[model samples]
Target: MLSTLGLGLLLAGRVGAFGSPTADAGRRGADDLVPARSLQEEVQEVAALKPITLRGGVLNAPPFAIDNGDGTYSGFQGDLLRRLSQFALEDDYNLTFVLSPSPTQYNEALNLVASDCNTTANPNPREECDRFDLIVGDYYCNADRSLRVDFSPTWLRTTMSAIKLAEFEGKGITTLTELTFAGGTACVPEGAYLSEVVKAKFPGASYNDCPDPEACIERLKSGVCQLYADDELALKYRALNDRSLEVTREQFNTQYIVWPLSEKMNPQHSRLLKKWMYKSVANATLDELSYDYFEVKFCPLGLSGPNCDQDCDPIHGLSDRDGRCICSSTKWTGADCSVEVEEDLNTYPPWEIAMCYSFFGINTLAVLVCASWIYWQRNTQQVKVWQPFFLYLVLLGCLVSSSSIIPAVQQSSEGNGNVPACMVFPWLFSVGFSITFGSLFAKIRRVYILFKAAVTMNRVTVTVKETFLICGILHLQLLEGLDSNHCRLALGVDDFCISAMLQDSQHRYQVFRVQVCGGRDDPKTGLFLRAAVIWMNDLFVICIIFGSLMHSVHFGPKKDVNIGDAVSEYARLEKESTTALKERKEKFVSRFSSIDSSAEPDGASVKRHSSGGGPADETIDVGSTKTTDVGSTRRLSAQISLASHPEKDEEDHVVCETIDDLFVEDDQVLK
Candidate 1:
């Protein structure tokens, strides 16, 4: 039985027609995005631009790109484009932000900006320098871009340094070579120039990027990218909130910024646009813009400008009101708003912390302990009828109690960060429930065999013959029961596909028919009538056979009498007292049989001594006897007359005496 159940579960679990409906059906389009390239590669490709219809995606310039409602562009890129639009159209040109439906579309827009199909910031000259001019957004000057376009002296100049993790301080990471070899890695924006420098200088070091400086630096707290490497100004904006990061390496190069114009660019109207773009790069022009966009600070005392304060806090250099930190309402202060106003732990909310702990810590073992207590209190010393079922239930409870085992083992063995859901539930249910059902069916077969033996001969061993016959019959019956429609949630039908059929009353009749006829169709009613007949027929046969065997063995004929002289003399007296004779007959047989003989005569006749006042009664049919009842006077005389009586009378008296003895023996034997 166990083997059969296990095989059934195995068959159900096989990669066959019974697989889950939702296994690999649906997927999202964004999941199909292509692999990302390095920042250097991205910049090189973006430098090569061409024309296209639409260009819109999220612009990631920290403090510059603002995500405004109604999907229209704003911020530094917005302001720069408006000024240049006067030169292109002689009026302000408004750039509109549009949502990219998917990652593929988003990347396509970025590619367009790179190719000059639409506007883009800081396209390199090596790829598409002649394709289009940079009208808006910051343009960086490189050795390659300088060959194709003109440059201003410089709009912004700051230190270019490597920001090592604070933990790695005092480790002598002065040179670019030492910074790369130092156990920590760095991060840079996807298309930024500094990302290129790190990749070139230290090919073995790990570097990552994000479009925005704040986002790129946030990875440090997440432990994604350990160090943020960018222009000093951008890193300073990030460090205002997270004061732990500090620049470890000295400035490698002073970066120059300029707007490039296409050689084939429309010189007729674009000349004025180029002049305005350069004019906009003036010191005061950028300083005000930078101050409005970001909370800037001068790092180190010597680099402080007139606006830069020498008394600025060392942690942030200087505080801008809108930076990440804020004063607590209760006088608490910290970088992440984690400081306490009072020293008491009770002042801190207790329930919330407890709830958080429970969410992560509570397990099935805790549930099992509670459940076991309840079971023990209820069951005590009582034996359960479904003993095997209860045993399997306990086994399942144990498995649940140790539920952490599989997950802990898997993680320790495979070194994976996550567990697969599909493998857990499917396999667990198959194993646990199979044991439960197998044990349950086994007990059922056992009880049935015991019953069959006791009813038949009163003595039958629990041999293989009885066990196999009983269990096999029940197992086949179980299979039949499983296939029945009502038990299958009453959903089976042959009209349409079975799975597609809904559970409605209309389908219920079909289910009923299938259950009754065992899937056989009847010609007259077009239903399965034979199923009910066969099922009931088997039950009826078992009932009749069992009942008959019990009856025959239990209430078979009784022949306990030994008819000697004693039995014969009782028979003579019994013949004389018919009332006693009738009562005794009824009393003896009433224990085993329900035959009605209670209406027999109450007295015997003296003439010819007939029982029941008639001819010899055959109520006791074990033997043939004719005894004449002699009256009381005659009874006394009969003893004297016995010697004088004729041979025929003596023969009759002998027969009666012998019959009486037999009745006495029979009665004693029966008792």
Candidate 2:
């Protein structure tokens, strides 16, 4: 089945171009473009001494060989064969192109090549064509052919893919193993060497001997065969024009395309053909032809790549002539790409293991340093050198605490229950010290205010020292009490003990005393806890000392006057001013009363006495006016003059002085 398809592809080559041309033009195997020395000069030199006649297949090989439709032949391979023939004949008889049309209906290319009468698809030894003078084309010179005819060191490299009708896709048939397992039948051209390979690989696979590759494809289309297997190039040739077929990625094998000649051929002719074919294999002409037909492929082996010869030899699926292994792609290196690296974390090298430390350490430090610097510049007011240092310490706490959290996370990931005591203690110390110091720094002024009010400078000095000493003692207290049954702050029994000692008044001092009596490391908690406690206690002392200093500066009143007395003085002055105004009004009223009494009674006395209680409630003066109501005084001025005038009869009223006189006693007094 495969043979018929391959034959059909071969016959259809001249109809249309297959695959892409320009796109794949340069994709010939790795060596396809490598320059090679010319064998022409050497062949010509040899030709001077010998006459050689080299005959090859006359039929067209498409891109390789063509019939030319006349008595002669031309094509890629045909041209190459003729050039080689000329070089081999060198000053000899005419080198002829013989027509070796497929003899058997199968037209197995090898059989044609093997026939004594002609050379065909390739040279072979089975048909007794071993006596041929010379031959070249796209031929697979197998081991048998190799013994019958010498081949150039480097042969044509092919990348093979399985091509099948699309209808057979997804049938669970891929490898020969799969076909044999599925109890499926296969078809191939009779006498093709691939038949022997398939039979060996899949002993149970049933196969039909088709006449040619095209027949096998026809049988496959007709459901007479489950599949046909052949080289990717031939299958691609058939699939190019037919939309009903497709090619797969799986490869059956890789074979070399080489030349063959009868062992009897003159050594000079054989050598010339060998050298020309090798050079041609790397030439541009073959590459151009290869692009239009087959999928250009390379022998990955023998290069420095993982699959190269030093890794895996192309001829065998195993290591090559060197001790170095051509590693399979399954192994990828992360370093220089030489070592076989493992995937498991446990197997990772020390440097890789340390990667996590670098990541966490550097990153944590960067954040802490930057944050601390920003915070210090913005919020700290004292401008003390220790301020940044303090901030640095706090940042250190944050970093340590953060690092401590990693162990827990890692433990969770690893599913390990053991908690590291060192990590736990330091994390706790950072937390406590951070909170304690932060609060102290925030309230420093408040502490100073309280302290300076209660102590003198000299006493303040003594108190501060005592405070620090007590702070140190308390810090020591905590350290020694760390592991005590009633003092430790751990999670289990030790935690209960720490809590009891710290919280129970009766046990607190005793806990400290006990620690003082005991030696260092006598069931002590840890150094970090001790250090953290010391820091916190010192912070407490600073707060207290600052408080005492503030108290000494502002304690009691610096003068006799109190803040309240100044307020009282303001109130007294305001009250006195209010009283003075009342007294003046009373004295003025008395004087006015005495004057009215001195005026005596008159004819107007009744009218005056009835209306005049004192001065008029409101006195109006020309250009000015003064109006007074009992206990209240108001003054107004008008510029208009007040002069007596003749009254109108309708509006005028009589005015009597007292009861008889209306003349003013003193106008000056009125003014």
Candidate 3:
């Protein structure tokens, strides 16, 4: 931004050509943006003080600017000034051209324009820097100079090229290595940036020290230099006037050709210059000026960009060494130069392999501990009952974690490797989970079947034939192994074993969780078919572990004495007490019958049954005992002689007995 000081705007009055602006209307549109009254007055006041413009226009670079013997400038630069003179500065300030620049005088021109040339305390500023205004030239733009001077955005790109004698061939993207073994020397101008590239490529190669582009071309003509290298525009211009020279059809390095305005140039003036030239550059007004100066209808432009097509064209006598196309292209990268990349779906990437190691280690340790626990506690009744189910879990874990100790080198498709993980884990998982879920399910099933039997028919016990099915399945896996392509993940889409062999262990873990939790495949791959075979390996593990831990659903209660057994024992005790009482009564009655003379009274003939109960006979009462026999039932009664309720109603104190106590399920009374 330009400072708001009034004198700065006055110092910024120089008028110079930068680039062209797209006309909102035409060149006359400037009438709409009239300059400030103070600004216009300042431009006029400055112009009166400085008599000559002394514009920093390049003098020696031909076709750009030419110094005719007359006291006026002519060439491409003149035409640029002509276009810019009308609208670049305020209308009242007279714009003029002055001191011409050359390729060799870049530093001098910079110092002169910056007003640092006079180094004294009372330093007098130069006309180009302080008074007359701007300098124009094909200055190589760089950041170092941009700080001291203000250079415009590139008006045009100066493409560099190599020129050879007539009858030379080869047209393509510039090869950085082409001239390295060219078997001869490459001539370049002594002071240009190209000298650095040439020197670096061939440190000891012969160099034709031409002072300028013109000298470089002369050396090419006189056979003093075998190859002449310079900017493409300059070479093409030279080649146009001379018949012996030929410019390579390819373009290589390029530099910026920009208009350099003084740092002291006014911000408002710079903005106006930009507004005017932006359209001119875009619309190619300067290119048109080059065309007019060279008197050619068509001119060349910068060659193919980074995105040039890589289709080597044989008809144009051009070919691609790398993938770059020999002709024009629209897309970037010039991609179709090689066969498509194929990522190994059966192999793990570094990070994925690392994660697999972690999973395998942890799971393997857990499995080993479980197996050890099962082995150590095999005698325990709980362990004994669940031995088959726990065996399945151990085997599945072993398969899941085999890679922990299985070194990569030892792994093979037929043996212990990723192939086995895919091939065997599924079977192992199925077997393990079958026992796991089967046992759990069987418990609930046992309850149902037992209840069903108790109510209707007979008991149903779980058959041990499940082991045979697992054995059959194992034999089936062997059958698959016999086939040539059995366990292969996918012959074409992926190897047999698919992504289980490819994905990280964590991914596989998530996959199993997803399968169990939601019945969905891993969302990452969404490959359910393959994942099914993969997850079926651990399905039982997931079901058993997850159900037991999460839902509190486990196998049946451990076998121990229960309330039903206790009630049965109590029933046996009651029957034994009754037998003891009957024995005691028999002993007493046998003893008393031998020593007594008693009267016998009976309702009818007493039917002898048991000593505890018989017919209603013998009017004698033995300690409140009474008995009766009716049909097939014998009733023995002991009177409840409540001392407190001697006159209780008969209904309340008659008898206490239930049908369950009187008869059992077989319709037999308590023995």
On TM-score, the candidate that comes out on top is: 3
lDDT of 1 by residue, 1-671 (tens): 43333233223332232234344233324576445457576334323422111122344444334556554446655555443332222222221212222112222223333434334444344433332333323456777555645443454556676565566566645445664677556677676566777678677767776765667667865777666677765555555545677665466667764444444444543555545456656525566666655454433432233444333333323334333333334445554344556533222134433432332234333334434543553332222322323443434433432342232223212334354642453344334334334444555566555454443324433343543354345445434423345532556567665444665655786675553545754222311222233223323432343344334334644433221333345545645666665765664455223213222222422222355765442221112223334222121111112323323445455445644654565466445
* CA deviation > 4 Å runs, candidate 3: 1-54, 88-94, 101-103, 114-132, 167-176, 197-204, 293-671
Highest lDDT among the candidates is held by which one?
3
The alpha-carbon lDDT assigned to residue 72 of candidate 2 equals 50
**Candidate 1 root-mean-square deviation in Å:** 32.7
C-alpha RMSD of each candidate structure in angstroms:
32.7, 25.2, 27.2
User: Residue-wise lDDT of candidate 2 within 1-671, one digit each (tens)?
Assistant: 43333223222331222333443456777655535335575344434544334544432233445456554555556545544444334333323334344333222333433433343544445444543344444566577665435555444466454556786667757555566888888876576666666677678888887866768889978878777776566666667657677766777668876654555566765666566555556555456556655542333444433344344333323332233444445454422235555643322234433543454465365545445444644333332322344434444444554454334223322434354653565445445455435534544543454454333221222233433343344345446435557654656567777778778866665575453555555211332344344444434443354344334334733444342344445556656766776775564556456434533212211111224565323221233343333334322221222233222221112212221221122222223
How many clashes in candidate 1?
25
Name the runs in model 2 displaced over 4 angstroms.
1-53, 58-76, 82-131, 135-137, 152-155, 159-161, 167-175, 296-671
User: Of the pair 1 and 3, which is ahead by TM-score?
Assistant: 3
Q: Is candidate 1 or candidate 2 better by lDDT?
A: 2
In candidate 2, where is summed lDDT lowest over 10 consecutive residues? 650-659
- True-vs-predicted CA distance for residue 154, candidate 3, Å: 1.8
Best-first order by TM-score: 3, 2, 1
lDDT by residue for model 3 over 1-671, one digit each (tens)? Answer: 21232224234333223222334235546567543346677556655642213345463666666678564566676667656544434444344445544335446555555535456622545433454356666666776667666777666677767788774545421232455555456678766555665567566456777776777777776777667777677777777777677777657667787777776666766665666567668668877876755433321222222444333333232333222334333222233322333433443335544544555565555556556655665665545444445355444544542432223212343333344434554454444444444444554554455454543334456554644454445445544435485454644665555666757666776775453555653422332333333334343464455334323213545455243344455556756776876765564455345323322222222222334664322222223433534335455344433333322242232322322233332134323
